[model samples]
Target: MSDEHEHQHEMPATHEHQMGSSLSMAVAATLHCLTGCAIGEIAGLMIATAAGLGNGWSVVISIGLSFLFGYSLSTLPLVKVGVAPLAALSVVLAADTLSIAAMEVTDNLVMVLVPGAMNAGLVNVVFWVGMMISLTAAFLVAVPVNRWLLSRGKGHALTHEFHGMAAAESGWRRWLPSLPTGALVSVLIAFMLGGLVVSIADEAGWQHSSSAAATTRPAQDNPAALALR
Candidate 1:
């Protein structure tokens, strides 16, 4: 055989790696999408605030940016690996967008509906504290749901197909196990619980408008807190 023929014969037809059932892979892929979405949502929220945008606009912009960035982040990783960038991008967009969007709705609605959460002002102790708690909770809920999906290969199927990098070996995967999914679930739970209490308070004629209404307030600087304050 000629040298060209020999070279072609050496490569395997398809690499057989372990991916669980399609359903499992689908779940994992969906979770990876959520991971991207959560990161984007939080980043957008921070960026909008840092820019001194108001609440309603900030959330709208943040959620919008979050979706874009989330999709890009998810796609880029797969592209950087061996997959065709276009195909990888398509798969990620297809698998994760809706699911993450649903989660975002659940997440942001809870934040906005939490009585005076939006209007607590940047300096309002309750508002700032509540945001921190909310972001933390979002992270907490996302991680395990992500990991469980990841383990089964459903959440990240498109990502898993690429040879550019190993999913489980990447920085994202490395940090996942120790992270806080519980805290987010708890915070959301608390928000619901507090809502019930607030409803009761209202029903009993003990309810009053919260001192803080949800407003899109500008941010102020705190050297000690860095951009965080």
Candidate 2:
């Protein structure tokens, strides 16, 4: 056989190695998408629940923010490396939108199907439990999608092919904080929990103030009661 033909043929070992690396890349891509989704979904849900928005509005807000954050995570690094803002955004849009949409849909559907999950409060375990379940489902669903895209050289492959070199050359990565996959997920969870605690405290304090005001108002309204006390 000619040299080109020989080169095109890969041994089983090399094929297996490529497969392993591709699988790892797909998982990492899914996790990156997951982190962005987690931040947006939690923040949107919390804001929606706190404001008493209906389920429809909550989903809308969540999806909007998910796209915003997802595209942001991909786009920002490129922009920092001197990629034009719009070009970076366009690449990220093509690279991330489908994955993000799939994730958001899967997670939101889980939330809706879980009884009372949409209505659950920030402090409620039910809300958090549903969130965990939804996010896990999103991750599971997105992995295969990302894998398929990567195989076609359509997903993060696009990023690796374009602008990946510029980012390395610019040395912008050193200036940015890098979180491992597990640590990134942990940080997102901590953020959600911290918000939950702060919201619960604020609500409790407001309720207490309202109750005290109600008690004092009645005493002030009735001089006899005040005098008797």
Q: In lDDT terms, which candidate is top? A: 2
Question: What C-alpha lDDT does candidate 1 achieve relative to the native structure?
Answer: 0.56
Off by more than 4 A, model 2: 1-10, 162-183, 192-229
What is the TM-score of each predicted model, taking all chains together?
Answer: 0.47, 0.74
**How does each model score on lDDT?**
0.56, 0.83
Residue-wise C-alpha lDDT for candidate 1, range 1-229, written one tens digit per residue: 6988876765443222333344344444444445555556556666666787778776887678768856776666565444566887788776556556665666677678777866544334445455545554555555545545555554554355464454455644344332233453455457545645554555455323332222212332335555664
**Over the stretch 1-229, how does candidate 2's per-residue lDDT look in tens digits?**
6886776775666898988988898898999889988888888987898899999999999988988888888787676666777998999888988899999999999999989889988876567778889999999999999989999999888888554444444464446543455887788889767756776677788899999999889889998997998
Once fitted onto the true fold, the runs of candidate 1 whose alpha carbons sit more than 4 angstroms away are 1-31, 50-52, 121-125, 132-155, 163-229
TM-score of 2: 0.74
Question: Per-prediction RMSD in angstroms?
Answer: 17.0, 7.2
Best by TM-score: 2
